[model samples]
Target: RPATVDYMSVDAEAAEVEIFRDFPFADFDISVISVEVQAHNYYELDTIFVTAGYAKLAVLGGDHVYAKLRRPLVPPQGAAEWQRTIARDFHAHAPARSEIGRSQ
Candidate 1:
């Protein structure tokens, strides 16, 4: 049967691009992906991820993290979304902005 992936971690050495191409990202909503990329061709892999609606979040050593922006995660959502949520919640709780920052 087919399955949905919330996260995927791939360490394909030099075959990272080939491995990534095997997945049909168009059919599923993948939340996050971590792939081990080679210094010489990580950009190619990044282009593929970008075409699939993923954004490069970070790079640690040889591993890179990509998040599918079309569907965002909660609790620890993306920084931009988190900021919006914080502002909205604050405004709902305190409409007036006092010297302390919260609205009276």
Candidate 2:
């Protein structure tokens, strides 16, 4: 088994939710997941992802993309601590200000 999975795309037709449920989330630090969902199992899939600390990013065609709610830290920190770290990092790397010009 690999140490971590950066991305995973699943198209299991009617069995997508079943396959996703069987995935080993505890064993892998999965950053992104894309799963094809049908109306019958959309809620189940969403619940599974949300419970696993993932948030829906987008829906491309029939595939729903989910990203990790909190990026895994090396030392394994708490969620609140991780959020603070991310906010600090974002501000540190982001531009101080932005200028938008409109053309008439």
lDDT, candidate 1, 1-104, per-residue tens: 33679898988878988877656887777888999899987888998888677899999889999998875343355678888988999888874545566455
Angstrom error of the Cα, residue 69, model 2: value is 1.5
Candidate 2 worst ten-residue window by lDDT: 95-104
Compared with the true structure, model 1 gives a TM-score of: 0.61
Task: Score every model by TM-score.
Answer: 0.61, 0.63
Model 1 misses residue 58 by how many Å? Answer: 0.4
Residue 40 displacement (Å), model 2: 1.2
Candidate 2 residues lying further than 4 Å off, grouped into runs, are 71-104
Q: Score each candidate by Cα lDDT.
A: 0.81, 0.82
C-alpha lDDT of residue 37 in model 2: 90
